[model samples]
Target: MINFNRFFSSLPLLLATLAVQYDEGKTESNAERLLKFGNSLLAQGQLAEALTQFNSAVDNDPKNYMAYYKRATVYLALGKSKAALPDLKMTMKLKPDFTSAFIHHGNILLKIGKMDEAAKDYQEALRQDPNNQEAKTNFESIPALKEHIIDAGQFVKENRLTEAVDYYSRVVMYMPWNVTFRALRAEVYMKEGSYYKAIDDYKSITKLKPDSMAEYLQMSKLHYALGDLEDALSDVRECLKLDQDHKQCLPHYKKLKKLDKQYSQAQEFINGGRYEEAIQKYTKTLDTEPDVPLYKMRSKAKICHCYRKLHKTVEAFKICNEVLEHDEENVDVLLDRGETYLIDEMYDKAIEDFRKADEIENTQRTEEALNRAQKLHKQSLKRDYYKILGVKRNARKKEILKAYRKLAQQWHPDKHEEGPAKDKASKMFMDIAAAKEVLSDPDKRQMFDQGEDPLDPEEQQKRQQWGQPFGGGFNPFGSGGGFKFHFP
Candidate 1:
């Protein structure tokens, strides 16, 4: 009561001392409080909220190993095993002597059937605690887990693909970390004709052993069989990266790259209407090494198409004939060649080709083509000058002249006696002369190529007005008194 100020100051010091004692003995820090809350929430099955608290605990103390492990537990409870993997890894890194973390890690690996990896973790946990019952129990099962692998191999040897696949699948499920089991399962899948499934297994094997070139080559072959050329090419390129001079890989890579490039370019040219360039690219594609039969047929068919588009009927026929020699029932090439013949006004050959194509595949396109060819053939018989001269549409002027001279001598009315034979010869001679007149003259030939007949009554009137001679300067019965020609 006498010194009140001094007593008050002494009271403050006493309170401060009490606060320090409580903090050191019973009171918890903010991080410890959050970790305790997280554990309580985890015990109550409130995983999302427990995860938040654990995250705060880790943030408060970056080196807190327990907080990381708790967060991993929360992740596992949430069915996010992959997400928990990093946290478990970090917990082991921070506190290597934490046997519980090792046990939990081993349990997770065991659930995935990675028995060998789980065994290693269990061994590490045993090393740490020397008395982990969970680690010991799991470690004891690894030998039994490996027995399934032996069974898988036996089934494979017996050629029982279905049973082999089942056994290998069991082994893989129990030993997912084992590359040999995965590869064995993949082989079984291949033998079962489950090619897509085999590819999936090989994809995992390549990831586990990136240096294994054979797995990559196998993947490339599967992709190729599926008609995924780009994917096949990509896998083969990965093989080349592992070993540039690899015997099987190098040749395959070259062939795939060449065919892919050539076919891609040819398609581009065709789309752009560049028939000449497309023809060149398709020809090059056909010549590429390790020749695939389908590829050769495809390239030849495309070449025929390009030539036809360019109105080069002879070239189109040559390429189409090559394809027919191998695949006679190829309706597409038949249609292409038939169209080419139609363009050259070779009606009989066009009709033959179209009818054969229709018989092979009676699609609307083929039926329509057959009908059109039939109709055109009937009309072409009326004024087919090439047929009358007995020369090809692409024959040279010399061939035309030779054919005309031979026919004129054989069918001349003067050569026959004055009887019914002479009457028939007169008619034949007039028809042959008209055929030569149209075919030998370039202007009239151009007109005929445009589907017009210069010797027709209406066309002859036009020729007269244009001062064009109907005989085309060839008079077989003129002053020479025999077959005579004025053309040079």
Candidate 2:
């Protein structure tokens, strides 16, 4: 009205006039300072950095309504809805009439999967400003969502995990940020034995609700099942940090930490070549954490390795046998026992173990062990009849028969049932029968004892045609028993 626009038309003239009164050193209002910096960072999508600014503003001026509101929004932007709730509550406390703050809080509650709390927040927003279309829409949608959730729960109660999983998966698709939906799906996955997928969902829930000690504890369990010990340790540690008295977490954390320490000590002993101490420590750890299957198997394998290093081949074989009884597919134990057997010149047994390990998983190490064991086992067959029967070179006929009888009963194919063990038993039984045939024949036994393979077809036939019954002139298998062979 007074031609003010015409008076201030010159940009340079207006700036010069303001420079005379402007004080660069004046203290800025806390709300203004933080809000300005927060908005700048928020616009750049630097959510964590923006959160620092907004949070500072709220801390400095707790009663500032906009400070609480902005801080909550920043928290939500960071996908940390659990952190947003307190700020949202403060915003509500300071300014009950703020419809947008109500909407923001409702959305945050929905993100964290708190559906009923979300409904309440939306209802409050609508009460203050009935024209809030966002509030009405959210409120109207809740009942239908609740219906679907109830339907999912019913299927779960009926033990129909597959259907329940499908319903929850769909809900999660619509609300990917919802920890509740993911939690239900994770439970179903675990019930279905989809452990890896269960691990993923549990891990996501930990991120969605970082303060959820229960979720972290569950994640640690899932990781442990998958043989991820370090990840389990890390997750359980996080769970304890959130809630040290967490009922399931505290005991597991203590047990794992202790077990981890003991395992490390055993490894140290092994590295220092103290095989006996390492074996004892490994046995102790196994006894302490018997329920942890992965750890138990690993400890058993370690003990077997220690036995091998100490040249206690029989003890090593015994420990490995026990581990395989519980976990037949444990490749590490299989390889350990196989290597030990090969070095001990029990070639047939070595070949059996290496071949079984290769069948389970064709790794380079298993493949190499199998090839080497097979090559050596064939060569050992004709030369080491007494060794094959696990008897002394100068053993008497009665001793040979006793050893053969013991081995035969232990390695009978029928005794082994099916699978690799049965196959191995069948093959080893053939070797055992060959050993008994050659050792029991005085002609063949003398030839074998004199460092010849009487079991070799050419040699056995020549000896029989010549009727030469060795230096003792003893008919090894009582004449009639000479050629009659019984498989072990």
Candidate 3:
């Protein structure tokens, strides 16, 4: 975490020491001084150090377009295209007539996969700097890509997908910077049911051609097919943001809204100890919206979860395997399958799936599942407390408390009927409470964090003698850990 960039960033004296003297009668502020020095550092190819100076300059004078432009330039050099976006946008807003800024920003956009946005920026650059070679080359390449795309489309319509794919991929390889060409190839990939490759292309296109409703719609559908409901919903929302109320978007928007509601209702039912009802609702939702692959697969996954909770292991395993056959990399289905395996005492099988899930996405939930799977396999009760709270190491007191409270409400036994749901909730409620009690105390937390069990019998006895004892885990502490999270 040591910021080496800080060394050359704020040290104004370094500039003079290096023979980059300030001009006489310069009455500019610290930010202006920093900007000039940062530009010089950039020219010298000291990128990281230059970034630090630019950051300092921005902190001192946020209104300085020159500082933003310089910072954006550094970000571009570092291949951090997204990092450059806000600064480049601010630069454009502050100095619309700066043709070079437009060209540079457009190129950055192109590199980052915002094809449509980059095209617009390049066109603007062309209007202002007609003879600009970079802008002209980029702008002119787009139409040629479009022509190639049309030829590829002819092959697509004739059901000659292999030829279409071959042709498009070749064109994209040649016009590597023409993002649209890659997008066309991605569409062909999707048609061929090469979902993983198509998803990859969709991801790039969405990033590159963000404002284009076509790209968003395509990505949304692909993600939906892949059982990535949240990503699908996100793409839909982004499309809606651009189109407002376009006719093509309204149906998708409405369907997603309904699906979201149905999904939430099913979750509530599950939490309320109505597993059968939840399954019914989930199934109904799936049946009603089979077009949205996201809802269909997720509903199936939830059905598996419900079956597992209901101790219908055979059914749960069956559904999970069936779903996996379609979308093998779905983390949620993998997690559910792993859980079912764990419950069946198939710990190795559980661990294998959980490990794969964790490798795909290093989420807190998956890490705990992985460890807990291995732990039980080894006959241990040692929980990964940090993973339990959905946090990492070095978490502050308030952060621990916040996570604890959120999970407490989420798994409150009172929310469920007196059954397996309640039993599971009761166990987790106690564990979360115990985790909070141990982690909230400074000395106990330090001990726990340093590989010592603070809840051991000897420590418990000492605490009881000191007029304190661990409560039977029943109380619910309450806050949420997610904003855009949805159970798959």
How do all models score by TM-score? 0.52, 0.57, 0.41
- Give Cα-based local distance difference scores for all models: 0.82, 0.78, 0.77
Q: For candidate 1, lDDT tens digit of each residue in 1-488? A: 47988888567545644554465446776677678778867887878878998999899988888889999999989867667878898999999988888888887787666677888999999897777787897798778667766777887888988987887776676556557778878888888889889989988887766587898899998887666789999999999999999999999898899889999999999999999999888878767834567677888899999999888888999989999999999999999999899988887898899999999888999988887787667648677888888897777899998999888888877789999999999888877887887788898887676556766676667777888765334454666434464432
Q: What residue pairs are clashing in model 3?
A: 113-207, 113-208, 114-208, 115-208, 405-477, 405-478, 406-479
Model 1 residue runs over 4 Å out of place are: 1-66, 70-113, 116-148, 169-178, 189-196, 207-214, 224-228, 239-252, 264-287, 303-331, 337-488
Q: After superposition, how far is residue 214 of candidate 3 from its true place, in Å?
A: 2.3
- Per-residue lDDT, model 2, residue 103, is 88
| Model 1: ten consecutive residues of lowest lDDT | 479-488
TM-score of 2: 0.57
Clashing pairs in 1: 113-174
Ranking by TM-score: 2, 1, 3
In model 2, state the lDDT of residue 190: 95
Each candidate structure's count of clashing pairs: 1, 1, 7
Q: What is the lDDT of candidate 1?
A: 0.82
